[model samples]
Every structure is written in structure tokens, then in C-alpha cells.
Target: MAAAVASLYRRVLPSPPAVDFASPEGKRLFAEALAAGTMEGFFPLVSCFQTQSEPAFCGLASLAVVLNALSIDPGRRWKGPWRWFDESMLDCCEPLDKVKAEGITFGKVACLARCSGANVQSFRANLATIDDLRRHLVRCVSSQDCHLIASYHRQAFKQTGTGHFSPIGGYHAGQDMALILDVARFKYPPHWVPLRLLWDAMNMTDDSTGLLRGFMLISRKTAAPSSLYTVSCRDENWKSMAKYCVEDLPNLLKGDNLDNVQTLLSRLIESLPAEAEALIKWVVEVRRKEEGDPSLSKEEKERLFLKENVLQQVRDTRLFAIVHDLQYANNPCCNCSSSSEEDSLTRIAAAVCCQGAAMLSGNLASRHGFCCKETCLKCIQANGDGLKTVISASVVSEGNEHGVDMLLPMSSPGASSCNSNLKNNVVKYPSSADVLTVLLLALHPSTWLGIKDEKLKAELQTLVSTDNLPDDLKREIMHLRRQLYYLKTCKEKEEYEDDDLPSPKWLG
Candidate 1:
């Protein structure tokens, strides 16, 4: 009876058309690639290959395998004090529940990689030719330091699914074939696919992103901290906190009564814990450029220290004062104090910066627009002079065409001051966050007190009124609000309430 059952199952099971990696033909394909020295990337991938934990975890599993293969630090504690990349830890871009309901997009996967400390360059199929993909595959497969993940329509290969993600393990130059270390092991085995066929599959559109599915080349990030104002991307309450910034904040600051605003801000500040502080310590690299090389120049070792000092001075003079002022706003008796105006100003600035950064940083980056820490720091520093110049000019209404700048800088005396190169690279148009930051900073009661020119004060007030806002500013606000709703729907954490427990009865 068992023999009959085995024979019946064998007869009924259907075989896949693609050449299986463990099959005889597949072995020959790999052997040929190996003999041709085109399989250098295979060993590392094969050793670290993993299957998807859930039906929709192909992207996460594939990313985990590549991350581990590159030996990038996961940063958070995994099981038993081990810091490793797993499917469960790849939640930086979207919530796991949403990912389970609907798999992630190629852009989101790249976003997750960037947030998890990996460098990624993603390519969409509709944007590039088949030769372009061929070149990337050859380069990735011939190099062990980097890896490739393909997001394709499985139906293109006559497979049993729609969209799928898998790491490419090897390439056969002569056959023009690539080896897919499929993460969905239960549905499909590892197989060799024709390069053209794979490209065609990837060239199809992903319904989720309305973009063509494609590939991502991932590598490890090895750079120092970038900015003095890095945000807390790991904060779980950032979602709720950000909603308060865009929604409840306008209503809170609606009136012109200084004391009322100050009192409200003070109460809000006191209600939150110190852990709610958003801006973290900005660290600069102080170590020698190269160890055991006494000949290493002093210039090399001191590269970032000067920049760090410049940034710290700017942050303190511009943003930190606001943070310090808001922290002490809870004292009602201080409303009539000498620093009352300053405190009111700082409270508004600090609250806006904290929540603004949370909203901006929480959004996933675009596919090809991954900004590293070094780049972020450079952008902040480079924009410093332009931002300061604009603020000094006191023409906030000029922000129609060129959006308002945010990060402010202090006057520096010597060579440690901001460089001319930084001044030359001022971003033409600031983001919506920068514009909003400028508007919030303009709301400082101290700003109004110092401004004797009614025109300047009126221009500042124009920024706060929704009806008087420029079309561009209105569009940016609407765009941010839409993105907030989309993100909340996709990444919001689910909450559940505990039910009452039944009482136990004892009979003696």
C-alpha cells in the first residue's frame, strides 16, 4: 500500500520547466560557469541562502540572506544576544502585518536596506535595456563583495505566482543564464533561468508601486556619522508624534496670545518623558585616519572635528536654544519673566523640529535616491550659509519660488567657519519640511517683538495663515498630508485591548 501511494504521488506531481540547480543539467550549467571563472559570487550566497518564513516574506528573506552574506551589522539585538539580520527585523520600511497582507515594492526593499546599514543601487526594468541588466548580473556574479536581488513577475517564467524576489546566486556567461536562489523553497526549487527571460519577467509592472519590477545591487556601508541632527528612525511612537505635528499643532498655535501658547506648550512638554527627545548626540570621528602609521598626516586625523564644531555651534544657536527653552516652559510664574519671550520662541521651534524630523525621516526613500550619513551631513553644512543669509535678509515671503531654508548657522571667525565650497552647493529648493521649519521659527513671539517693521511681521504672519499661503506651499502641505495618510495606512501598528479575566472559584 505504501509503495502504491509513493508511485501515485510521483505520477501526479508536476515537474517545473526550468532546470533545477541540484539536477544533472543544472549541475552541468554550474560546472561550465565554474570552469569559466564566472561563478565567484556563488559560494557565499549558497552558504547563506535562506527560505522565506511566511508566504509573503520572499523579499525579507532575500534581503536577510544578502545582508548576512555581506556581513553588515544589524545593530539591534537578535536572539541570545546575537545581532543578525532576519525576516522579523526587516521592518524599517513597512509594518510586518501590511507586508504579510501585501508584499513590499522594489523601492521599499531598497529603503529597508538603506535604513538597515547597507548601500543599495536599484534598477527598474522598464528604464533599462536587456544588455544593461546583463552587464549588472555579470558584474555582480563575478564579484563576491556585492550581491543582486531580482524582483520579477513569476508568471513570465510560467511559475506558480505573480511578483517575487530572489537573490541571483550564479551566472553562466556562455548560456546567458542566471541562477536564482529562490527564497520560496516550498513553491519552487533553485533553478537556472535564461537571462532574457528573467529580464522580461522583471520588465513587467508591479501593481503596488505602478513601476516596473527590477533588481537591486547591495553592498555594505562603512562611513562615519553624517549630521549633528540625526533623527531617531527606530522610535516606535514616531507615527503618533508626527500626526500631532501636522494635525493638532496648527490648532494649538491658532491664537496670538503669547501666555496661552506658552502655557499649552509647557503642559505638553511636561506630559512627555525625556526619551521623547528626538535629536541625538552628533558624534565626530576623532581617531587617527590609519592605525600604526605615525606618518599619517595631522590633516587626515582632524578632518571631521572642525566640521563637527561648526555644526554644533550652528545647531545650538539655531535649534538647540529652542529645545532648551521649551524644556522649561512648564513654569507658569515665568510668563512675566525676562526670558518669557525667548522661552515662547524656543518652545515653538523645538516642538516643530522634533516632530518635523520624525515625519520626514519616517518616510521611505526613493529607489535610486539613497542618502548616506556622510551625504546628509554634507547637505546640512553646505546649506548653512544660504539658510543664514536668507534668515538675515528677513524676507520670508520670498519663499514662493525658492522654498524657505531651515538649519541656521552662527557667525564664525576663522578657518573653522563654513567653507566656500559648502556655500556654492546650496540646495535650490528646500523640502516641505524646511519650509515648515522656517514658518514655525517665524512664529516665535521674540521674532515679533524684535521686528519694528510691520511689513516683515506681516510677511511672517502670512506664512501661518492657510488662506494666504503660496500655491507651492499649499501643494507641499497637501502632498505631505497625503503621504502621511498613505504611510499610516501601510505602516501603522495595530493595537488590541485585553479582555477581562474570569474569576476562579474554590470549594472547601
Candidate 2:
């Protein structure tokens, strides 16, 4: 699946208009810079970071790039001229610095800065003095602040044609340094309690980079332990934090202790607000990624898939049910007759039937040429209404082919004599209910004339006896059986059709 997705990405990403970052040149430059370990070569990256209006996107993209790079070179430590840039780039921006000090690292700070010609030294210096600014102005400036500072700095370094750290002392440098300090202080603070909490929240520590990636994807703005500032926070930032939390799940699942991971997952799910349905979806996606195929007999893999898929479906279905209920309550008996609850119920029923059929098909595919006798027996024993519905429908269709007019609804056909015999034959010892009943029924010439086995007969009887069977399903089975019975009776009786009676299409 991963390979298929990768192939799809490759196919879709290379076309014109389909791939949009900006101008064709900009897109090319962006791709090149991404490949070259520096965003300094890309105008779009520089522009994006510089604009800084959407820090989440910039931050996420940066993290993705960094992670991709690290994945490629898992054993190597990030080093060279980029090291100083990494350390100082985010330090220059107050908000960026805060994010970093809160355990988020300068993953793409160096790359983005190198791409944009932001005055890195000056920006860093300004961090210190920026604190004294009026709260209103500071807020305004902070809101307008561009992530481009890093890109700008990177551009300067590239233009200089030197990897050496050349500190050109100036007003900008001074300002940048001040801002860096302020950001650092804002992120860490003087208080020990917050620091301890932050430390405790760090989920993973990269030994090579000495960087901490958070396990708990809680938003600093929303999770500040104060409701007073709630109105001031951006919802998007909270969502970004949630994404990080979800992205970390696969790694967390792969951790040493699975029980601990499951506990954490439960707590995370519990803590999620009702509005964060997307976050829940992301968690499901992460779980899917972490889990292996359930078909595997291996205990660990099967357990993981079962836990993940079931939990995901439960969460999704609950959300869906809630939304549906609210919508129904809000618009009780809307005049739109075409969009009725009955229609929805029918659709759900069809979906259930389709799912059952697909599952059976999958089983058949896996066991190619091997009869699913055991699985069928289990289904019979489990008596899943949905599975029973599908099996009865299938058998009705099969019986129609051989001209059997069993009047029973598709839920229960009195025990099939042939199926009973097969079951008894397969198993050494069978109860009287299981053996004698089916055998006695099978011995009858009428039952044997059309019916092949007790299983098929039982399925037909189930179809005939199902009281709540959908009208459409009933009509379909009745129509098919009528056609088959007519054909059989016509062939036996040799009655000449009157001109008024339409000739059967099959007769032609």
C-alpha cells in the first residue's frame, strides 16, 4: 500500500497545473532546494517563511522535510555550516523561539533561513529589545511576523560564498540578539514547574541531534491552564499541535512497551474535545499505519490490527451517529419526502450486505480452491444476521437456477438435510438434532429432486421465513423463483403458450 501510494504521488506530482507552489520556475527551484538540503535556492520557501501568516503550514512542511532527511540518514548527525544557522535562526524570532524552547526543534529553521535573505543576526539581536514594546504593537508585530527570517539569513550566508560564521555586528544584529533572548525566556520561562511539565511531556529524544519531539500533541495556547487567554488563541495552532500528536503515534506504538502505548492512546482519546473529530481521524490513520494485516496468524500483528481497526471504527461510528442524530432532531419531518429515513435505512442495509459479500469474497480469494467449509460452519454457529442475510440471498439465487420454489423467507430454512449430512460426515459424532433431522429430510425424493444439500436448503428456508426482509429483496426472489418454476412447469407440462402470453426471452 505504501509503495502504491508512493507510485501514485510520483505520477500525480509531476504534471503542470496539478503541481502548484507558484511560477514554474519557483516550483522547480523549490524542488531543487529541497533535494539540495537547503531552501535558500527556492523563492517560494523564502516567500512563505517571510510572510509567516501561516506558521503552521511552514512549520509542518519544515518538520516533514527534516524528518524525511533524517529518515534518509538515520545514523548521521545534522552538522556543518547549517548548525549555527539552526541554533540562531529560530532564536531570532520570538514566537518561533517559543515553539522551539517548548521542545519543538529548529528542524527546518536553518534550511528555510538559508533560502530567504532575512537578516538573521539582526533578527536575533532584535529579540531582546522587542520585549519592551507595547503589548498592542507587540501583538500586531507578532501577528505580522514572517517565518522568512530564516530564509533571509540563509540567503545571506549563500551569497557570501562561505560556510564560516561571520558575525557582521550592526543594529539589525543587536535587535536580532535581543529578540532571541526574549524568545528563549518566553519559551523556557524562569519558573521551574512549567519547565518540569514540559520536560515530562517530551516523548522522544533523538540521540544524534539531541532534539526532543513531543508525544503529547497539546496546544500551548489552548493548554495554557488558563481560560482567560482562550479568546486570544488561534484554533489553527491547536489543530497543528493535534497533528503532531497524531504523527507521533506510530512511533509511540512501536515503542518498547505496548501496554504503556495503549494506555497513552486511551488517555489521548479521552482528552480529545468533541470538535476535534479530525484529530480522532488522524489517530485512526496512525493506528492503521502502525498495525499489520489481521489475516496474519501471528498473535502480535492480529491483536494490533484488531485493536486499531475496531477502536477507529468505534470512534468514527460514534461521531457519525451523533452528527446524524443531531441533524435528524434539528429537522424532524422535513417536507423532503425523497430523502427519508427509510431510504437511509435501506442504504445502510445494502452496505451491510455488500460488506458481508466482500468479506466472503476475500476469504475465498485467500483460500483459493480450498472450500471455506469451516468458515461457513462458524458463520452458521455465530448466526450473524447480516451474514445470514447475504448467505440466504446467495442461496435463493442459486436455487432459482435449479428451479426450487421454497416459500420460506431468507432468514431460516428448516435445517437442510444435505448440509446436516455433510456436517455429520465431516464430524465423527453428531447430535440427533444435527444428524437425524437433516438425514430424514434428505431421504425424501421431493427434497432431493431440486436441493443439492442441506446447507442450500436451509439457506432457502431462511430466505422464505425472514419476516423483516426488504420488500425489494422479496420481490426480487419471488420474481426469479416464479420465472424458474414457470420454466420447469412449462418444460414438464409441454403446454402450448397462447398468443396473449408473451414468449419467454430464453425460449428464443
Candidate 3:
């Protein structure tokens, strides 16, 4: 049955476009394929990364592979299968043994081998000397296009504690300075570092709130993937990671109420070094002017000073336009409006953003106050009546109880109703009273009116007449009929209408 379902999914879903390594169009298509959820496209995409010599693409491709696998079999809870595959591909020990016979550093070769399977217990145990690992890792880092190698090194330093050369401060401070330089080189290279690293670094230092900002950065950077993206992206581990990230973020934010923008900005600024103090001071001044009571002239002077400094730095980096664009979005000069609908949408968008952010940010928000169970409870509490009605209606229609508790209104009664009727020797309806009880439960909230299933409605209508149901169900059904009729009559006579209705001006 599962195979049939999988086949049907494929039959209905079109294959992704072919990726060409030679052209920008090819890269875009590959990215699209990765984003579209095509698991099968992941390997091909990663292959493109290898050919293009673009490390960012390689890191992203690996991520896509991991994410795709998770999406397909989230229930399986697979662990580090990629590490196994990576190790098998390198087979470093055989070559290393041959090289050992020659008495060379052989660092580059060791690094390459380790990159594939650094997570493996054997690799972790063996890659002892930083120079040996750094030699290989640094080759990729210096190349600027070796994203996979860079990523592997970053992971290695993070995991194995590279003596004095940890990219991240305070981990292995007393280790060799050369090793530390290697770690730092991979981390803060002149060119683009993987966004995942930036995000992870931020999360490891800060908390859930910090992670949320990272996700917003991703959403702003990349285009969203469709169902096809999943297939093409095809890294089960990556998919799982992404899903876990997405699901966990909202729960994390909700737990601590870290929703303040000011708090977020402060955290970002705090993450910088002492050399960044001037920049931080400038940021604070600008923020104060924006939110402070100051003379117009003073505000103008402050703004001009900040702009001149920013422009100077932009020119120095030769990234003026990009900096201008970023500043434009962050600046108050941009004309943006807030609406109630926009607010609601932002909340939903934030939820989605958190998902991707959560994964790349490591498991930052996975702990803390973010509890899925709590989120579920809050969702139920917020829409108590509506959810109860929907669950009740689903239960009545499905006629089974998989695990749903009608007693707990938020419990999805549909699962219960579907499962209950399947059991052997169980009285399906129990009695007419049970039928009427379910109907009354369904009618309590306005949300039920939106349930458009004709058959479900028809089944409900059948219950309106007591004759078809068992005695107990019939009794309950009659009670509902009485209550509904009374309300209808009361409504017609205006007895339930507000007494504060005003008289017309002409009558006055």
C-alpha cells in the first residue's frame, strides 16, 4: 500500500528541470530542484557543487540532501547515515597507510578523507594532529570554492576541539596557535561563509531569540521550495533537520515571549568584539535618536555622522550597493506600514521562518522553554470552542476513536471516531443518545458551519430524526431538537436581541 501511494505521488508529480553546471541558469535550476523537495535531485545537485567548485553550493546541497530524507521518513528517526556514506567514499585509511610508508605530513589527503566522514567515531578518534587535518582543510578554505571541505573543517573544530585553533572562542583555547589559525581561516574567510555557520555560531552563543533572527535572514535570502523541491533536494537528514527547526521555533519564542525587536538588536550587537564597540555605539545613538526625545538638529547631525561612517566602510569593502540595500531595509527612511492583517500574517510567516532557522541554528531552540506539547495546548486554548466543534464533527463523521478523547474538546475526535468503528464487537453508535450528543458537540461553535463535506452533513441530518438511531442516541437527539427549537423561537421574537437598540430620529 505504501509503495502504491509512493508510486502515485511520483506519477502525479513532474520531474525537476535538468541542472547545468556551466551556466547561471543551471545553478538556479539546481537550487530550485533542491528547494522543490525532490530527494533524488540532491546527489545531482551536490555533483554540480563539486564541478562548479562553489563551496556554498556544496554546503547547501548537503543540507538539501539531509532535509529531503527527513521529509520522506520523519517517523524512522534515522541517524547520521550521511556520515557512513561519506566515510565509505573516502576510504582514507588505505591511502594513508600507503602514505605513512613515505614519511610525509600527508595533511591535505588526511583532511579530504576526514571531511567525508568526520562524524564517524573512527575519524573522531584518529584525526588527532591539527596540522594533518588543517593541511587538508586549509586547501579547501584557501580555494574559497571548497564549501564541503570548509564545512567539514568547521564541524571538525566544533566537534573534536582543535587545540589552540578553534574558530569559536573558549572551546580549546590552549591548543596549537596554527590549528587555531586554521579554524579561524575557515570561519571568517575573505569570501562568503556558509549562512548555516553564521546561524549556528549565533545560536550557540545566544538562544532561541537569536535563532529566530537567523531564520528571518534565510527567508529574506532564499526562495521558498515547493513539493517538487523536496524530491530534487533529497537529503532525508536535511529535511528532518529543517522540519525540526520549523516546528520548534514558534514553541521556543512562545515560551519566553522574546518578541521584542529591541532585545533582538541588543543581542546581535553584543555578539560582536571590542573592535566593533564604535559601531555598536553608533547603532545605539541612532536607535536613541529614533526612539528618543532630541532636538531635530541633533538628530540630523547624528544621522549624517552614521551615514558617512557607513558609506566609508562600504567603499572600503567595495560593497556599497549591497550595504546600501541592507541599510535601506533596516533604516527608518523606508516607507513601510503596519496593518492588523499584516500583523496576523507576520505571525504566521515568523512561524515558518523559525522552522528553517531552527535547523541551521543547531538545536538552539530545541530545548529552552519551547515545548511542542505546550504549543499544542495553547493552540487548543486559544480556539477552544471552534476546535472542539471541528473535532466533534470529525469524530461523528469518521465514526471511530483512534486516540481522540471527546472528553477533552481539543483532542482530535476524528481519529477516535475512525478507529472505534473498526473494532470487533464494539457497539458502533452505542445508542441514539450518543448520536445526539455528538451532534450537540458539533453545533456548539460556529466553525462547524464551514465543514463543507456533503456526506457528513447528510449523516448529521439523518440524526435529526430520532427513529433511525438507537434509544440512547435518540433521547440525546430529541434533547438537542428541543434546545435548538427554543433558541430559534426566542431569536424570532427578538427576546435575545440587545435592548440598547436606538429608536429612529423621525420617531424621536
Among these predictions, the greatest TM-score belongs to 1
TM-score of each: 0.52, 0.18, 0.15
Per-residue CA lDDT of model 2 for 174-269, tens digit only, reads 112101101111111111111122222222343423443221100011111110000101123334433333343333333333233224334333
lDDT per residue (tens digit) for residues 1-508 in model 1 = 3454432111111234468888899999999999887788888887888889888989999999999998886643343324567787777567677788898877778767665666667777766778988888888889888899999998777876799999998889888999999998877788898888899998888887667888888887664222222223344565555555444454444434334333534444444433443322222121111121222234322333343343433322222223334532333344334355344334433433322222232322121132111101112223222212111111111121111112322223232224332232222222112332322432322333333345544654443333443333333233233223333333432110001111112100
Model 1, residue pairs in steric clash: none
lDDT against true structure, model 1 = 0.53
Using lDDT, rank the candidates from best to worst: 1, 2, 3
Global local distance difference test of model 3: 0.24
Candidate 2 local lDDT, residue 383: 24
Q: lDDT (0-100) at residue 54 of candidate 3?
A: 24
- TM-score-superior candidate, 2 or 3: 2
Name the better of 1 and 3 by TM-score: 1
Worst 10 residues of 3 by lDDT: 212-221
Backbone Cα, N, C clashes tallied per candidate: 0, 53, 58
Q: Which stretches of candidate 2 lie over 4 Å from their true place?
A: 1-62, 68-125, 128-152, 158-324, 328-508
| Model 2 local distance difference test score | 0.24
Tens digit of lDDT per residue, candidate 3, span 349-409? 2332232222222222231222111111111222222221101101111222111111111
lDDT of each: 0.53, 0.24, 0.24
